[model samples]
Target: MRILAISHLFPDLKEKRYGIFVARQLSEIHRLGAEISVIVPRVWCPGLLRHTERWKNYDHKCPLCRFEGIEAFSMPYLRLPGNFYNRWSGLAAFRAMKSKALELHKSRKFDVIYATDFFPDGDAAARLAKYLKLPAACLSIGVDVNITAHSSGIIYRHFIKTAKALDGTLACGQSVADRIKAVTGKSPLCVYGVLDLEEFSPAPDKIPARKELSLPPDKTIALYAGYLTKRKGVYELVEAIYRVQKKCQDLLLVMCGAGPEETALRRLIREKGMEHTVHMAGEIEPERMNKWMQASDLFVLASNTEGMPNVVMEAMACGLPVVATAVGGLPGAIGDCDGAILVQPENVDNLEKAIVKVINDNQLRADMRIAARKRAEEQFGVKRNAILILNYLRKIVEEKKAKQKG
Candidate 1:
């Protein structure tokens, strides 16, 4: 059990599906044996802001990158760019990787110090675990704390003063562990992201996944995948797909990631004419998102907030049928789960009547596509959420060895 994960949220080798679920929860906590390393940071990107669009994927070659095979690093510091001084980008990414975190803590002698973003990756792993005394933890993953440190006030007082130098904290739902106990009263441990139900199952249907992802033949679609901003409710999902295309005119929605409000949501979808009912598609590739979730049928997330959203359990591990939006940790991850539905955030006629009742019911979309892949195989598996992050980072590394044996 040797970890040292600091974060700008994982993913490298050029944003390979950025933070691919924090690189599948540290490669399922290094296949349960543990031993992981990562550092990410990176925020310099100047030089005419390296050709806009968020610094054109901020120039890569970020010192020593390797994801799936763990051992990662990308440090690069200096702040005050966009995100107006992100409350001192985690102590300036822990003073630009404090001497490479003390030269990789004198050669991999780590026991703990993980984080996945809560002000510059949990404020640079709680200041590099207070100079390597070890034990520091975090996970939070829901808009860094329900909307970038609860929409700042000096980044919510430096997120309750660096989450009291964290010794443990984990979340992804339970509404981001009740917004980190309503802003740092701290009580994380939520557990909700990680899905590799064999790279999201359910195909062999939806007409061979829309004939191998060419999609749209005989529409009905509905997809949506993340970003395109407005807190991902994506302009109330293009105003409920322009009133469900004035009555499901062979409906279709599509969306899929890429942010900074994609040119003002494509100019409000061509001034509301919705150019044949919204279909952006943009950024795709987390291994082709399971053929756009088994070529879509139903899966929408008009999110105004969320802590539980790995594209709503990869659209319920590809069996589709979901609707989303009962804000963060999505009503305890798809409230009562029978093939998900939730809705409410920024309403839009209750997300256009649950996307026109799952696209005009056909036996309630085949019983919510078999209860949404049996609730992603009895709940978000991926080695049971990486053994709840390996027994909560091995009980905070045995509570710092009982505080160094009292």
Candidate 2:
């Protein structure tokens, strides 16, 4: 089957880590016999922001490029931040990519239009599919339901229209699927993200991985990777790490990723005198995540909202137990995996307790490690997930074809 994968969050020359999960899934789906092409819409910034470093890096990006053997194209679209601009931005993106998508559809004979996220991608896909007379499918990764639909804005209504228009819809977790039902009164398939078992595996020698990554070998390391913003509960994570440090001096909290709250987080670390205990290992390449996961004793994320986080699955595939807040699709993602423990969001005391428990108990840690790997193999492998999504896509295409004949 041939598909045109439309996603605005996909990785481009400027941001390689952006929407890497989407990239990874497409690669595996391609391997599973689906011919896929990608359309990544580049957002336009106005005035001084256009000349800023953020926009400058993307200024000279090639219109088309091959990302991991798959043909991908980037098109320019006008966009603005926040919910106020959601509808306009989505329309702008659709207008920008419509011509290219139509041309590609004629040449490649795509079977369907598949969008990776709801807002701009799914919304635009709905518009494009109507124009081209093809089936459209959209998958909710996180933000569309957790942030966009929940907001008291016109985007909430826009989301319903887009959801209802799509021929098929998918959510990364049951919580997201539930939100989709509430918004559009349509049931969406819950398809979890893929875990690359080969890439993320237990370290044969933890000390060696620590040595390579420059992490302290003598300490019990806990890792937190993602944006360093309040919404990610970075502030709470810092406080929890500090409290845990008081009881276990040998414990170290390793943070990977950068965001707006870097200054505040650093200040909090200094105020609590946790400079030595909390190591800020800013953004690293996606390829190097396994090293951090393998080197760490456990993983922890105190995010306030999420949609089946790929990091949790990555940690599990690496055989590292997790201590994450019970929010979004986390409960569904972790499931009955004894390798991880869940706690309430924004609770530093509870977060600290879970972290300390995972750290102090060697037997539990060992059992968790085994369970984590077992769970990844059973339900989260990339191949299995690709097959599930591909089968569903095929069913949608066949049904559409049958209707056309009828």
At residue 157, candidate 2 shows an lDDT of 80
lDDT scores in order? 0.80, 0.85
Any runs in candidate 2 off by more than 4 Å, and if so which? 50-66, 183-185
Worst 10 residues of 1 by lDDT: 60-69
lDDT of 1 by residue, 332-367 (tens): 877887787887899899889887988888898878
Clashes of 1: 0
RMSD of each: 17.3, 2.0
For residues 1-406, could you state the per-residue lDDT of candidate 2 as single tens digits?
A: 9999998767655455678888888889999888998888877655567576445444425443345647888787877556777766668889999999999999999999999888789999999999899999999997778887767667788888889989999998888898888877878888875778999988877999999999899999999999877889998888898889888899999999887788888888899889899999988788898999999999999999888888888998999989999988888877567988999998899999999999889999999999988888887888888898898899889988999999
